[model samples]
Target: MSKLSKLSLITLFFWIVKIVATTLGETAGDLLSMTLNVGCAVSSTILIGVFLANLVTRLLSKSCN
Candidate 1:
């Protein structure tokens, strides 16, 4: 396969994976807050922690590069 084709296929696969993961996360979040009674406040705090961790990792990676 050509390099372009391979790269395109990889990109498409990554996009599909991202979509599936996002959907699963949303569903799980609702289930936690509604069914498990986790509450929006706790969920939001957890999500904020995740966001901060991701932001820090991205900043560190970019600086390293």
Candidate 2:
């Protein structure tokens, strides 16, 4: 119930979400590469751009904390 405990719980949840997101992203990128007949380097570059765009959008949104 303490602030420190609450913050730790939130931090832990964020880390869990991050891991899941990265795993999903990696899987999707590989699937996309195979479907598009692209190489790993190209696929990674495209995925990175997509991820960054989403991150920027999310950070800039008014609802973001």
Candidate 3:
């Protein structure tokens, strides 16, 4: 009903989505690198990309605040 309440619900939904998505990504990454033999380099690169994206977002958010 209120603005803060709406924002809280949105935040909770995003947190749940993120948890599921992260779990799915972990499973998919293992399947690709181990089951499909995609190699460690490819899998590591994918992980590094995720890390860098998070780092950049954190930096940007901190600067905005």
lDDT of 2 by residue, 1-65 (tens): 99999999999999999999989987888787888879888898888899899999998899956
lDDT, candidate 3, at 5:
100
Report each candidate's C-alpha RMSD, comma-separated, in the order given. 3.4, 2.5, 4.7
Q: What is the C-alpha lDDT profile of model 1 across 1-65, one tens digit per residue?
A: 99999999999999999999899879877877888898988877777788799888998884765
Clashes of each: 0, 0, 0
lDDT of 3 by residue, 1-65 (tens): 99999999999999999999899888878987999898888987877898799988988884765
Kindly indicate the candidate among 1 and 3 with the higher lDDT.
Answer: 3
Residue pair clashes in candidate 2 = none
Question: With candidate 3 superimposed using the best TM-score fit, by how many Å does residue 27's alpha carbon deviate from the native?
Answer: 0.9
> TM-scores of all models?
0.61, 0.64, 0.57
Candidate 2, after superposition: displacement of residue 17 in Å?
Answer: 0.8
| Candidate 1 residue spans exceeding 4 A from truth | 44-65
**C-alpha positional error of residue 54 in candidate 1 after TM-score superposition, expressed in Å:** 13
What is candidate 1's TM-score against the reference? 0.61
Instruction: Report the poorest 10 consecutive residues by lDDT, candidate 2.
Output: 28-37
Top-TM-score candidate index: 2
